[model samples]
Target: MLTPLFERRIDRMNRGIAEGSLTARLPSGETRVLGGRAAGPAAVIELRSWRAMLRLALDGSSGWYAAWLAGEWASPDPVQLFALFTGNRAALAVEARAMGPSLLAKRVWHWLRRNHRSGSRRNIRFHYDLGNDFYEAWLDSRMNYSSAIFRGAESLEDAQAAKLRAMLERTATAPGDKILEIGCGWGPFVELAAREGRSVHGITLSTEQKAYAETRLSGHAGARFSLTDYRDVTGTYDAVASIEMAEAVGRRYWPDYLAAIARALKPGGHAALQFITYDDAMFEAYAANVDFIQRHVFPGGLLISESAFRALAAENGLLWQDQVNFGASYAETLRQWRERFDAAADADRLPAQFDAKFVDLWRYYLMYCEGGFRGGSIDVVQITLVKD
Candidate 1:
């Protein structure tokens, strides 16, 4: 139905291709290579309809994703598929000249996403409650839902362990220290802290996550988890830590979230947080787009921009005295996950309840995120917030 728009966008993109910017191979066997030979990532993307392409071209990130989920298009390699889009940024710029969601629509959506406690719980459950067995097919042994820190090229398992050790080291727990962890996923941090003789109190809103963490840490004498909201934690602690959880707090609640951390920490306490961070430009651009991740992956989540974080941290008196970045590792993490997931699906080992649509949805999620980190569109930071 939107063939006219699709044709027009491709025509504009063709101009950029003429400048040696990109290459494309359509399913119809037509090749478009602007200033150079028609070499591909040499892959074919089967666009099932111009309607899908129109949605992609106009609806921003969420557009293509919804189409893909609806079986409107597919590629042999999802990772390479995203690389094609991300790699051909110039061509997309040409195409997007006057095509995007309206500001009024964005404002309406932003206003709708309030991220209250119940909504946060629903969002967490929506993603994490997909079942542990589903995750076990792809994730490392510990099942960290965030980026794994890699030292050079390494196995995902080793990289995940390395990441855990980094967080545990940064916490620098002492015997009998009362450490509170917000947004603890599956309780790896709690187990590690318990092993160090620290009494670890961890909270998460996901009921499945809470059950899994409790079972996983059952043998650890000092580990406990509560289905508690972050805003309700009143106990002071020797240390507080959260990994990749702050982003779900919503930008509007950044100050209150930071204040919660500040309140949870004892005087002179340390807080270590791992954040999937965005720079100013990337954050602004992303905030303006139809985020497929927010709609489909983490419903109530929003990215943490370094600028917003700094401002809120300053306002809340939470200062990052130490920091490290290992964002490049996330690409590899997603790569291994996608590989494992594909292998498992090929083996038909995924849950019988999972259909092809679910498979495609997850594939897009992993590959899409991989593109973000690989292209430096986003970064991950480990910051030690000091309560000064």
Candidate 2:
């Protein structure tokens, strides 16, 4: 009996014939072609065997589509279908067919409006309010969620600690100095600065994070965690830093975010910012995936070009003192996260949702990120600025 795989290949071939010509050109310039008829503006795709098509569809395409079409891919939760489906180009083509670009952008914009309110209390709470324990499970104990600095390090933990150390050193923390931290997740820097005899004020949109931070810093004098947006902050600090929280601040808010920092920093004060971003020019191939991320993972997040970042900083009276790329470090960091998540995923211990979402999400997040990293589509930048 003919297998299902053979039948699917035949079906795809038939579809190709109906649409346009499918042909193969050998390296020696010999050409073999197959088609029902020559039509206007023929769509020509290389002839692929049944097995090759199946492999490409399942592995190269989105896992969601793979699961749907072949039932071989894995997903922990049904809710994950949206995230997975967004990675499939074919599915996006279908979507583009049903709804025009303007309509799709409008829908995405609506989602953005709901989640990306710069300096809004609701916006911060939407993402940061996820309990501290949940984040702690994956992130380092110090809760450093930003990219790790892996220079001259043998392990991820050591490298992350080094990155934190590098951040503090670059900021030039001093005793009794006033410091500001934007997007202070769980207050690691706040606690560290206070311990070193610095007066620290940290701002976050997430009430849950602020509450945890308050409890963490209660006994530490000269340290305060405010449940406020970064853009609304007004104060002159001697030093400022935000670790890995820049991704949450969308590209449209980059100028505003930096301006706020500049306004809050005393002249000669230092600011350290660490973020993961993609080069805008390299995004055409991944537009569908980008849209999916903005909708699901981070609403209103913008991956601006490097030139745009420099221009914005210049406009805001901020001078870029130092910048480092930890794109490779992120690969290792994410790998560790995947391993830890997989190792710890026990049905009895973790919430059903957590376990259900872990596998497919982690795999998709890792593999696709690895591909992007290899392809130079993404980057991680650590920029240190001085108020001019």
Name the candidate that leads on lDDT: 1
- Cα RMSD (angstroms) for every candidate in the order listed: 3.3, 9.3
Q: Report the C-alpha displacement of residue 18, candidate 1, in angstroms.
A: 12
Q: Model 2 off-target regions past 4 Å?
A: 1-111, 114-123, 283-290, 352-359
Which candidate achieves the best TM-score against the true structure? 1
Score candidate 2 by TM-score against the native: 0.72
Q: Compose the digit string of candidate 1's lDDT tens values, residues 60-124.
A: 56777877777777766666555545445544532322143443565566457657877777778
Single out the weakest 10-residue window by summed lDDT for candidate 2.
78-87
| lDDT of predicted model 1 | 0.76
Whole-model lDDT per candidate: 0.76, 0.62
How many clashes show up per model?
Answer: 1, 0
